[model samples]
Target: MARVERDPTGDVCPAFEQPEFQAVRDSMKPNPPGEPRSEEEVLRMLRDSWKAGHDKRVEDWNMQVQRDREERERLEREQEQQDEEQAERPEGEGQKIEEDNGKKTKKVYFDENIAVGDTITDRPASYTLNKLKLIEYIELFYFTPDGCRKAQKESRSTASTETWGITQMEGEVVGLQPISALKLSKFVKPDTELSWEEVMLGRHAMIQEMMKLGDEVWPVKVVEAFNTMYAALDAHPMRRQEHGSEATVKYQAHVRREWYDRQARKQGFNIGVINETLLRSMRDEIIDKKKTESLREVSVQGFQKNLYSFRLPNPYPSILSE
Candidate 1:
């Protein structure tokens, strides 16, 4: 191979030259320079070219095949890498596991009266709510530490970044779903000197109202938490009173009176001694009604009239008349 300084170009393989394949034509004379050859002559020239460049053509074909194989291998490696990356990523957590029929569900110590030191657990098991007293309901406090810590962390972030956070606490001011004990007694009205019997009536009225209403709708979490708390409360040692029979007797009397009156009303009669205080209250109510009526009287005229009257201004003679 050689290059001419006058015309710089890549080396053309001499094996592809016509003279190099003259042996294929057995030294046959070529068509005259610039003369158009017939189809047969063109075919003969192509055949001769192929015969001379057989090695060169094979080398070129092999190179192209090698390049294609490398490209395919590179693509396969890339695909494998992508698949490995996908496999490495983890899935989301806290998905509910389907319960097994043969396995007994685990129960945790659920106390609805959530204390500060109590460890709240989000367990991987089903639970129940147990109750002991009619007024004292149990509640669970599972969201305390874990939920509150997360909430606190969120407060830290949001308080630093957002406008609402400016007014909100950067740290938690309270634990998750903290318990607020109710002083609502069925036998005593809250913040009032109402008697236990009066409280019992109010409670009865409330119960009646509750019975008249449809089922309460609570969120799934709320229901579960309540159930857990009740279960613990029911199992607690203090669930049943050890003493106070006198108080119990008094309460039972009130309940029995209510039951008796209810049954008696159904039979078109009245039973049990009505409370003296209650009777006094009814009498006072009647007296108030009579007093209100006594103060009332029929009006002869609903309103005194100030009828609109227009008077012609003082009748005066004009200067022109004078």
Candidate 2:
């Protein structure tokens, strides 16, 4: 073994005293305690230095790895929160959400049209499943539980069951739905009560909804049914009587005069059924007159603006001809 090297003070070994040293920092060779270090001791000192630095390096690397792991976890949590918000927001009216490949997309919604030949199901009550889709909808001026009950019973084919009954406002109905579900459409908890305005307003809101459901051409009979019911409700003895005959009221007044004519005939009042042929002729004449007047107004406006160089020919000469 090499002899131990001491500090200048002589009582202490340099390795145990003062600051720890690297090969480059070992400048204070002192008198070395009066002997040079042996090859065995020199090699041992070098190995000891290598072990100390190696241990320190391992500890530093472990601390850096722990910090990296924490950063990654924080980023993952933030990303999850962002994804949740995008998945829920409905965006806009008439807009639909579609998702694909962990992403979301929004598109405008349009109603799907149902053709006359297409098959449909109408289940107003348990027994009355109009598989034929023949009967459209019904309306009644009722708010009483028994009013609803008796109206439905006289009209209903069966008893109310757990899964079946009625809950919608019994207003005049044209077509029950254009394929939309109504909270006003189905039976609900018996305890739920509704106000007069709520009942009538719900029906009106649903009628507007049906128009948006791709129903461009409403069936004639359905239109007539709506006209009949709206008139009945409007003229009800309990209606807000102070309402004046405003243009709005006049416009909605039952245009189908046949309703009263038919009712009168059924009651044995002597009046002929308006001939369908003559009715068609009269309707055509009214429509033709309106068109002519509309065209003349447009021409007058165009002339005033100097946009019309001459009068345009009538597009429907055959209809205008005697």
- Say which candidate scores most in lDDT: 2
Quote the lDDT for 295 in model 1: 58
Q: List the residue pairs that clash in candidate 2.
A: 139-171, 182-185
lDDT of 2 by residue, 205-273 (tens): 334333433334344444445545544544544234332222113222222233334544653221222
> Model 1 — which ten-residue stretch has the worst lDDT?
124-133
Mind giving the per-residue lDDT tens digits that candidate 1 earns over 1-322? 2222232123344442356565644434456576555545755666666556765555566666677799999999999997786666665321222235446889888788977666433321011010111212211111223322443454445444433111111234422211111111122222123333343333333333223332442234433433333233234343244322223223333433454355446532222233335434444554576667655532212222222343456567585468
Number of the predicted model whose TM-score against the real structure is largest: 2
Q: Which stretches of candidate 1 lie over 4 Å from their true place?
A: 1-27, 30-48, 92-322
TM-score of 1: 0.17
Candidate 2 local distance difference test against the native = 0.41
The clash numbers for all candidates, in the given order, read 6, 2
